[model samples]
Target chain A: MVRVALYTLLGVMSVVMVAPLVYMVSLSLQTEAETLSAQAVLWPENPQWGNYAELFVKAPFGDFIVNSFVVAGGITLAHLLFDPLVGYVFAKFRFPLRNTLFVALLATLMVPFFVRMIPLYVLMAQLGWLNTFQGLITPFLMDAFGIFLMRQFIQPIPDDLISAARVDGASEFTIYRKIILPQTKPALAVLGLFTFVFQWNEFLWPLVATTTPEMRTIPVGLTLFNQEYFTLWHLTAAGSVILFVPTAILFLVSQRYFVRGITLTGLR
Target chain B: MSLSARYARTAYLFLLPALVFFTAFFYVPIANVIATSLHTGPQADVFAGLSNYADALADPSVRHSFLVTLGFSGGVVAGSLVFGLLLALVLDQPLKGRVTFRAMLLVPYLTSVAIVGLLWRNILDPQLGILNRLGLDQQWLNEHPLATIVGVTLWQTVGYTMVLFLAGLQGIPETYQEAARIDGASAWQRFWRITLPLLAPTTLFVSVMAVISGLQAFGQAYIITNGGPGDATDLSVFHIYATAFKTRDFGYSSAQSVLLLVVIVLFTLMQLRAGKRGEVTY
Candidate 1:
């Protein structure tokens, strides 16, 4: 009896959780008249695949997707490369001011991005980087969280592995490349996925940084699309789906790592 | 050369990129924000100490924005915790489809906030919303705007909090519950005596995170209502954005941003105090 109650509760909660996404897709499939009709249906009688096609035609949505990929991809690549390098140093190397530097990075994590927004915008504007990809991508290229995550993951590798490599006359960079890099692949994956999803879904900074439609990322572009075409629910839903589906796929493909990433960073 | 010196040099080489980036992007900008907050004008060269802060504090809109921010954060934190803990407990059961349910719930979290705002805005539209068709005629975005924003934020965030709680729940050893069960403790008694006490740390962490994110909420208000219907849903961050970007009040916005930082720091300190007072050795 208890088991039945639990399943039923879970079933209702799952529907409530998933209803918006279902509604989004369903609304996207409806014609404009059907969408604005007096009676709203969960599923449209006639599926309108044309809404998806209309998204590309109505806006430079294809460019927005490309921009999203490029920005997210660039940030992820930078994090994968730089964060692990710094993490490896903090993990394996006994260096001057290492602990202090690590603490400083952790402290930076506490300073919310909003505090720096005005000045960062000014700096970007001064550098003539406003509306540019570099403006959107540069400040976020390497974050304190990524470095911290990489350090925790890299600390577990045995010291002897690095010692042996050094004794064989391997350089620090080579050791990082050959031994540490391969060992830290799982951490790298987690950091990479986290950065990618974050950058892809990032809205405020991109919205603030980029002004032109062409420079806008998927989320920003879709929002602008909504603001302009507020009444067209079908097109707006389609645009949201276009912006959302890629990240959803990424999350599903690496659901385990995504959850682990949240739990690991969440505690800190 | 000493071994330590060699290691230090190599480490410095590795650290160069991060240090440079942090200096250029993080440290300098923060210093600039503080420096600018005390000054006047777009160029911000003229010194006008505390004036911007005074203006920001005295402004009715700013005061209203802070109140709305508090209400919104409080609602989100409460809603997420209550609902999230319940969902976590339900999913913790050895049900056959728990994994599938958990994954399905996480879709909202994976979706972007901007998209969430757009989707919810459509769903809550008074004239054309499906909810209206179901006999609810309230204007969600316009009427009870704070509740609407909080509900949308809860939708996007509760799954994440659930995942965190689930991890915490799983970390708890089964032996304690089993021992309580063997001692003739009812399920409610076991939960109240054993589980609730143990879950305190996770609860604190989740609430702190929710509060921090809630205070910083912007996209929902900006996207859904544009802080509209007479500033009903204007939040601190969105207010700051308007002051700085829309109204071209950099100094004032910087002051507001400083105040926000202060609010966040106080919350963090409170969490530290709570964590210290409620330190569970287990």
Candidate 2:
């Protein structure tokens, strides 16, 4: 009886967790009249396909999607290259100030990104990078979290492999490239997913930094769409569904990495 | 290669980019903000002692914003953790066909916070929402908007917290539970004295992550409420954005940011202390 009750509870809670998503998908496909009907439709009677088309026609969502991809992709690539190299050095090499630098990086993690907003914005404005992809991606491309993630993963790799590569007259860069980088696919997949999802959903910096519609990411763009078409819930839902697709696909493909990343990060 | 020279060169090579980027992008900008906050007038050269801090302290909006921000964050942390742990415990049960359920629960964590905010705003829409259609006619936005926003945040993050908890639960040794059962402990007692205590480290880690993430919250409020219905959800970060860009009071905004950072640091310190206390428990 207790076992049966436990299953029932989990079954119910899981439904509650997923109901909003299901409802959003359902509402996106429902006609305005049907959506606003006195009785809610759990499943749409007639799924409207035009709402998805109207997302692009009615709003600047296509540009938003492109902007999201570019910013997220740029940040992920930068982190992958920069963090791993730094992490590899931190893990393998023991030098003066090594401990200091590592501590400084970890300390940097504690300082809230909120603290630097005003100064960063002013700096961006001064550099004429505001409302540009460079401004959106540059500051965020290399982060403490990525470095920390890379450091945690790289610390586990054996030293003898790098030593063997070094004995073969390989330069430090070559050792990092050939020896360390290849072994980091799993970590990279995890970090890449995180960075991509984070940047794709990033709203504040994009909203403040980008004045032009062309540079707006999907989240900020979706907000503008919400404000512009407050009356059109169907269209808004459709646009949200569109924004969700890439992230959902990425998560599905990288589920194991996501699971491992979350677990290891928590373990620390 | 000698140890000293090879170490020096390799260290410099490894640290170059991260140090440059970190200093320029993060530390220097923060330092500039502090300097800017102290400066006065258009030239921003003359130091005005403690004036910006005084002004920020006196501002009712900042104070109110701090209170509201605390309330919202506290609600999210509590809600997410409780719901998440509950779901985690359920999912951790030895049951048939649990894998599919686990995947379904994780979908929300995978969804973008932006989409989650937008989805919930409409999900709780006053007139035409499915919630209203189901005869729950309380005005989620106007009447109890704060709770509504908190509910949305909890829904979105519960999955994430649950996954962490699930991992933590799995890490608990089976022998401990067996020993407890052999000693005549009931299941609930075993969970309370054994499982919960063993899970302290995970709980501490999750709590710290939750608190820090909660303190820096931006996307959800910006998307859902836009700190709306007359500034009910005017969180500190949102206020900082408004002050810097909308009002163009960069100096004042910097002060606000400092104050916000101090609050987060204090919270982090408290969590670290609590985590230490838990370490003693084991």
Candidate 3:
């Protein structure tokens, strides 16, 4: 009886979690007229693939996808290249303000994004960066959270690896490239995947920073779709499913790394 | 060059990019926010003292927005955590087809917040929603505004919080439970005394994350209710957006933003304090 109850609970929770996503896929494939009808069908009676086709053909969705790709890609590369390096410096080097710098990174975490959004907007405006790809990419490139995560992962590595590389007359850059970077591959992958997903799904900042249709990322584009298709349930669901595909693919591929990232969150 | 000097140079080289971004994006903008809040008028380059904050405080809409934010945040945090913990406990038991169930549970967490908002808005729409199809034709948002929003947000987030708890539960060593069983403890007693105490760290983690996220509850309010039914669910972030963009009151918005920062920071400090207490006891 106890076992049955537990299974039932898990089953119900699983359904609750995935039902909306399934509903999205279902609605996306439905013809406009069918979707609008009072007769609700869990699965579309006829699957029309043209919704995805119209997204690109009629709207600037292709531009949105490209913009998202470029921005998320840039942020991921920046995080992977810079995070571990800074993490290494903070972890290994005996710099004068090492502790202070590390503490500063942690301190920034406390200042919620709400506090910073307005100022960030003004700063972007002042720099003439608003409505530009630079505005979308630069602010997000090197997250404090990524740096902190990398630092934690790097701290546990033995110092001997670095010393041994140095003893063989490796340049400092060479030592980092040859020794530290290779060893921290797992951390880098996790950080990269995280930065990518976050950049892709980000809404408020992109909405605020970008003005033109060209500058909008996937989330903002989807928001625009929502606004334009206010009463069109099928199109809204289709847009959402379209947005979900790349993120879902990325999540599935990097799920193990994603799990690792989640594990590290509990560490601090 | 000496090896130590070379390494130092390398370290700084590695640090430059991240430091530059952080300074420009994080520190500089935050300083700008502080400056803008303290200044007012056409240029906003002139300094005015405490006027914006004073105005923000005096504005009833701002106060009402804060209250609405509090109500929404409170409901989301409480509802998600309770349901999440219950689901986690249930899933922790060894069961058939658990892996698939676990993956399904994580689907909600992976779904974009915008998509979640859009999906739920339709799900609870007074007229055409599937909820109506089940013969439960009620105005989910209009009738019980806070409850409706909270219910949807909880539905989206509970799975996420549950997975986190499940990870924490699985981390607990089996020996502790075995020892408790040997001592003739009842299942309830063992859970209360042994399991709960051990789950402190996870609880602390969930508390800080949930509260911080709760205080920043904007997406659901923005996409679903649009802070409607007469500002019933206007979160602070939404207010900041409106004040800055809609009203063009940059100074006033900055001050309001500062209020949100203060609220979150205080909650974080409180969580840290409670977490530390648990650490000491353990």
Candidate No. with top lDDT: 1
Native-referenced Cα lDDT, model 2: 0.82
Which DockQ value does candidate 1 get?
0.82
lDDT of 3 by residue, B107-209 (tens): 6777677888899888888776776765677886887887887887787677678877888889888898899899999999988897888888888888788
Give per-residue CA lDDT, model 3, range A1-268, as digits (tens).
8998788778777787788789889888988776666777778767888888877765688888899899889878877888788888888887556787778877888877777788777778888999988888887777678888878888888999878877798887887788888888888887887778878888888888988887788788887778776877887888788778987887777767766677677676
Task: Score chain A of each prediction against the true chain A by TM-score and list the results.
Answer: 0.97, 0.95, 0.96
DockQ of predictions, in order shown = 0.82, 0.72, 0.67
Clashing pairs in 1: none
Q: TM-score chain B for all models.
A: 0.96, 0.93, 0.95
lDDT of each: 0.89, 0.82, 0.80
A best-first ranking of the candidates according to their TM-score comes to: 1, 3, 2
Evaluate model 3 with DockQ and give the value.
0.67
DockQ leaderboard ranking: 1, 2, 3
Residues A67-110, candidate 2, lDDT per residue (tens digit)? 98899999989998898888887788888888988888888887
lDDT of 1 by residue, A76-176 (tens): 99999899999888888887788898888888888888887899999999999999989999989799888888888889899998899999999889999
> Over all chains combined, what TM-score does candidate 2 have?
0.95
RMSD of each: 1.3, 1.9, 1.7
**lDDT tens per residue, model 1, B1-282:** 999899999999989999999989889998999999999886777899999999888999999999999999999989988998999999998889778999988878988988888888888888888899778878867778889889989889899999999988988899999999999999999888888778888988898898899999999888988897788999999999999999887888999999989998898799879877986654
Cα lDDT for residue B100, candidate 2: 75
